[model samples]
Target: MNSSWFRKLLLSYLPVFFVVVTILFFVFFQSLNEQNRKEAIKANEFLTQQIVLFTDNSLKTLNYQVLRDTLTADELRFFFGSDNDDVYRNIQATELMDDWKMNNPIIDSVYIIRLKDNFVLGDGSGQAADFVDQPFIQTYINQKVTAGKWTGKRSFRPYAVEKPTDVITLVQGFPHFSTDKSGYIVVNVSLSKLKKSISPMYNPKLTYVRVTDEQGATLMSDSGADGENSVLSHYISPYTGWAVDSGPTGWGLAHVALHFYNIWVIIALVAVLLGVFWVVHVTRRNYKPISQLVSLIRTSALINPYKGQSGNNEFGFIQGALEQLLEETSKSMQQNQEAIILRKKHRFQEAVEGIVSIRESEWMADLLALQVNPVGAHAFVLAIEIDRYHQFIETYHRQDQSILKFVVSSVTGEMSGLRDATTWAEWITDRRLSAIIWVPDDADGEVLSGQIGEQIVQWVQSNLSFTVTIGVHGIASNLEEIRRSHEIAGNLLQYKAVLGTGRLLRPAQLEGSEQRVHDYFGTIHGLSQSIRIADGAWQKHIEDLFSQMQDSISSRKEIESFLQFLHQQLNRVFLELSKDYRSVWKDSGAELLELGRSWETLDELKQGCLRVFEEMASKLQALKDSQRTRAVISDIRTFIEENYHNPELSLDYLSDQFMIHAKNISKLFKEAYGYNFVDFLIGLRMDKAKQQLLTTERSLQEISTEVGYFNYNSFNRAFKNVAGVSPSDYRKQQTS
Candidate 1:
């Protein structure tokens, strides 16, 4: 009967005891349910995985076997493409199909349809019109193209009396992978036998399993107790594109737990009620000390930013600060998400750029995660560049620029998707977006890419203020091919200098000129020769060089490279000129060299370089004609007079010795001394021979040999022709 406050508080512990006991019971049941579910999932997934792997292995083996025979086997190839059907070869082909059936139980029938004359060949059925699968064969023959891979499940009846058996077919074009409609080779795989190989016997009461195609349509469904309502796990068959779903019977662990433990539900409700009362008792006792501290903090001005926030009595300032922190945290999280997206784009860029290499499986996973299509049998890469990029920059702010680029890529993606082509696109620069597109092997990926390019150009022109140029690379078949595609497509944008903008540019349009590779060394040599002599042909050579550049459709960078090379060579030629003859070229050439790099097109480059060349040629010719000529000719005359005694001394020898051209020396000789190279050499040699005859008494051969003639007869004729007398006769008269 003692009424103490401690006794009342001790009595409140009774409900807390029951609450703790009930929680333990609930946790035990929850753990058991979770454990059972995990076990079921693991077991089912394992079995489903076995089905997928086995099916893939078997089908892949058969596919490769037939593909190999089609490509390598003579009998099979002859049966498909041979105009004259040899009976022995037909039997050999039948034997091959029979071997396929004996080794693999999955092969139901194998046949060849020669599209040329509606002829069919199969097991025991020669090239006859009475073939049972004529209608089926004609369908593929009429389509004129066959799939290289196995097709989805379809019903096939080999004989008239038999019901349709579900089969997956493999249809290959004649010559294995070619696109010719000349013939087709079809292999029918029995779905029943394939499933039998995966699992000979599967129970229906305990679980449900279904295999579905890419369209989510059911291709094969097991006799299951629960149907699809209790699907626990799903696996995709990489070979057949069918989904493998497995699950237990209805209600699984839940039904058992619910029915057997109905009493626990009532007990749990009672425990919750007890928990509520216990919390109330504990909170009242705990609130007195904590509330006093909160009251003191509430009076502070930390949360007084707004009336609504500051009005709360206890813990209001703390809640306001927490609210602001949470808001900031959310904003930071959004930034982090954006960073994640940017990282994904960066990774893609690296892959296409071949900066970072990844395995095929990992790259495929990344593409799937990005919602980008995986590589297909036929793929293409496209580069879309904004027209007049400088104008584009001035027309929009940075944010607007990003938005416009995003629209470009997004529109391309949508257009390609509508065409049933798989596409991935991203902006790789401020004004350029790149995309990789893939279509079914049977579809025309190059044509699709062209159509998509045209649509993008038209759409942008209609909706936006700017248009774009699209450069499409040729077809690609694999990941490595895609990297190559990226390089070509990205490089194609430089062709815009010649192809122009606001249109679709295809490989066909640009491929012809890309092969028109012209070597510039020859033109460079000719230009150098003309400049050395300062001939009028310098302008003609310049025109020829630029015309080749135009015909080749060289890019702006290529043109710049050529011009820079031209400048370097011409500058070397200019430095050799006399100072008084061409002092202004040293300064004017620098200004012209700078101007050379600013050309936007071949025509501009051609015209600009032509003007520079005209000035240069004029100055060079003037310099060559003035004091420079006098100085060079004087040196030439002195060298010939001293070297006339040497047998090899002549115009070519003097030209090499002086580092000048023979033709230039000949022209200068006639200009300076009023005689040709041969005439001057003869007159000098005849004078020396007469002096030798008068003083040394040398023979005619010795005198001719001493005067730069390897052949004596040539020197005798020249001496006689130049001095109007034979060298011997002239020497005798001068001596007497």
Candidate 2:
């Protein structure tokens, strides 16, 4: 009866125990899964940002290359210039483009359009007009673009292939990479090759990355896990305006991490089940016999017979449970301790972002628990960023990048630690890190100067391949001001474009900059008038524009705004001009305007702008010269036509008749009609000779006399030179 009752009780509770254990495991696994998913999303966001950075760097490199070749490559000079009729040069130029495309797989094709003739050239020969992306090229040709920014993805069919290819194109105009009517160099980047170039940054098996274009269309996506779940993170790039969607193509550590949690829960459940079975066995043994009861009680945690207490078994049970609890607690604490640094970083990041309200004491207590809070002090934030981040990224591998970031955080923390303050630093971004220092309110002014930031920069420059720039805000007197301090520090980093990178920037440097006023309208008007007349002062106007920016602008946006204003003024000046002059700016002046778009400093801007402005002035001068010579050449042509029968008629005769120099007439004549005085006169005589030869049945001598050549032999020679036959034979062929 007792055995049957014991079995009944065990069976009744076993189902409930299993149900409860299963529910607990399910909840634990669900939480683990959610955390893993969130981590995957964050990882994917980072991957997308890296892709944008890489692509932008590559584009800048290509732009510089195109500019260099167009200006300095001797092989392409004839092809892009007026000597394009040289078929060998056409071949050489085409070969050079082929080399560019071959050297970089990212460039699927390189095409050039001579704006003068609408003549196009690309790889392997065929410039397919109907279906080869000529419509897009035609659109840009019709509309004058001030500068070339990277275009979004489009179907670029370089040849008349059966299928169209997806490409992101870079349109750089020749004469200057930015503007002008010379020609355009359009580079089509293959999405597949772009992915291949970027593939080195990640493990393909673990995750997949998709890069979109400016239009939010997918340009290329690496082959990753083929499912929606494979894409765990999606973000739009601020720089390129492209979207990057990333997901686990297969189970990565983050994706399979929940399974580990599930396994742990299962192990724990198994232990609990073993404990239940041991208890059942102990009870079953106790029922074996009264003789075996004491031995069973001694071996089990059921009772302590030596104590002889009624509740001894309860004490033993509590002792055994406590022992198990202490062991598990020790393991749990180890796990928690491993996460301390992560939690500290998380807490600090939250405070800096204002994601958590810090006016309350709760934040302070949390910081204290994390062991990062100062007892009594004011605080400020320092923003340190890698200078020339594009170069930095290109120079280092993924692991080296992490190591450099660690070095940054460590040096920042250690440097600030030497002072009378508590400091903590963490990577706030891939290329930037932040440090928060709690110092005494009476801290010296050096807090903003030759102290921590200077030392950090010196060390990084000395030891690392790259240098860093640092920016700081005023000390935060209150808890709520910490986020503002951080934000101000971040803003100060922008001055690297002005003040130069690799230095410590303070709030004092920004003082009085915002209050300065600029008068651009007066100078802009002068520049326009000067450019219109091919005056040298237009070059000086460019300098003045840059000087205005340097003097009045303190921020990047302000500089860009001033440049945009200057561009509009120039545009307005030229738009009002005639088409002949308008073409000068539309074809060539835009390139000069483009010079200002990507400069790092006012000096760079001044030099590039000056260079292009000088070119624009030169072009305007040449155009004015052409206009002056046009009327003289016109009169010269009329006199030649009227005096063709005068055998002594020559360049000197025409120069005397038109009152221009003989050499000038020859030069202007060739410039206008692509023939010199002698050849042109010979052509007019030859036409009259051919008409008379075929219709009038005139003798060769009389025909030669009637033409400019008084000598019959000279007339026959000139006639043959022009008509490829003797005058008598040419006449007979037509007469027959």
Candidate 3:
């Protein structure tokens, strides 16, 4: 009877025990799975940010080059001043575009259209010619000129030789200086190339990422997707009118709750099984304790084991009380577990909102020396990137790579050493570390930078055996300026000098600083030279010079005083040199005049000064160069543009007209503009062709002869090479 009861009891408890353990296991694993899901979502969000970053970077690059090309073309003296046939001017424009294309391979072609007439001028390689009458062209021109911002992804003629290629053209209208003609600058970038450029930066596992305009038309997308499946339309990017999507359904809330259903199913099964078992166990367990207390009291009353007072003995009373308390405590614990779960929900909500903050005063305890008291403090940042880290991962076993990284991390920590008041170190990122120090407020920046360098050198030598290049930035007043200083230092790092693998740099010490100083000092020299010898005004003039140099160096208008000084100095030097040799003065004067025309930048002015000084010294060294040659070359260049359309125009003709050798003329022409005479003429003719093709109803034969081409065959070949189109095909695809 005892054995049977024991077996029954064991069997009864076994189900309860198993059910309780299974419920706990389900809860634990479910919590873990939820954590994993949250991590996955966070990772997805990070990837989305990366996508935005990459797209913005690509646009910045495109905008910079596009602006440079547009401004350069707009400012060209010949591009604005030409009075030749419209066809020749158009052709010249196309040739200019080819040069831009050669420099920026990503840009397919660049063109211009007069918004008033829909006059199109471009360099494209296919039969897709510029159309002045197309609705899309008219819309693009009107919208861009009015908005004054680039209009994205408008249809355009491809080229004169090939099929029309889909392209994204940036259009903006720039008015002509003289005439009422309002022209638009159009930069056509092949959609295929844009897609190609952006696609490779994305992960292949991604469904598809795209950049679309405000109209929701796809501007660029990765391979293997139609418009509906594109990642761009899924997530909204408030910063740039772009959408970034990754993982799951490529939408917002669906991605967040994708795995919730499976989790709910498991939770339901665990809850139901545990509910039944818990009810049975509580009933049985509660009765046993009560029954034990009753039996103990009854036995004490009947048996008299404690003698005459056994019924009310301390032991009997205590036994009954302990049994009752044990049963109540277990019940209370069960209730409390449910209550604790409710409290946890509130705490979890707070964690999700991510609003934790500590008072500013409390932050000092955790702040690094580099971060604290940064006002009037010199700080620098270093960005260390591992070359082809992804490629390296593919070659090594996963376990081995992990081990290597562990070793590297361990060494980095060991070498960083202890932080102190004067110096501090931080592991800024996984691949990079930074060390910052406090120097005296007026300390020599170079010396302080050198001390930091020595510390890094010693630490690296004693720890890792691998080679590393260190990029050091000069000191700045605060941590915020550290970023820009670091950029300057990084650029210097890229330049090869005697810098060793363990090199150090203070940007203040680079040739970049020297250039800035020269600008400052040049202003002073120019100011002194501009005015006649006014007595005792040198100090006042120096102060004024410093004040003016503080303005932007690039603005040519603000630097008029500096230019005037340069002109006066050139005249004075020429006069002084004329006493020794009259021919020398004339040569110097001609070189200075030519240089003045090219001095659009301070760097250009510097180059001009250096050249003049070197030439004058050559005479002191008893070397004979040319006085008349410079003047002749400049005159010949001016003549070519004014008369390029003459069928009799030739290098030999120009050389004979100017009484100079043809070879010498060719050499001078190449030196001045970096293109051969024939090529230059072809370019001039092509620019004219583009204008006429877009502006006039002239036949191809008439346009060809008007641009100085005698034979149709020669014009066709030259036009194709320079404009990437034939004359008639270029004219047919008009878009006004």
- Top candidate (lDDT): 1
- Candidate 1 error regions (>4 Å): 1-323, 373-378, 387-400, 429-431, 440-443, 459-467, 510-519, 528-537, 553-558, 578-597, 611-736
In order of appearance, the predictions have TM-scores of 0.39, 0.48, 0.34
Candidates 1 and 2: which is better by TM-score? 2
* CA-lDDT, candidates in order: 0.75, 0.74, 0.55
Tell how far residue 703 is off in model 2, in angstroms. 5.7
Error of 3 at 688 (Å): 83
Using TM-score as the measure, the top candidate is 2
Model 1: per-residue Cα lDDT over 30-107, one tens digit each = 667667767877888987898788888988888888778878888777666565456776677778888778877888
Return the lDDT, model 3, position 362: 39
Q: For residues 585-680, write the lDDT of model 3, one tens digit per residue.
A: 467657866775545334445556556645654563342234456667779878888887789999889978998889989997888779888888
Off by over 4 Å in 2: 1-346, 440-450, 512-518, 528-534, 572-598, 615-635, 652-676, 690-706, 716-736
At residue 571, give the lDDT of candidate 2: 85
Comparing 2 with 3 on TM-score, the higher-scoring candidate is 2
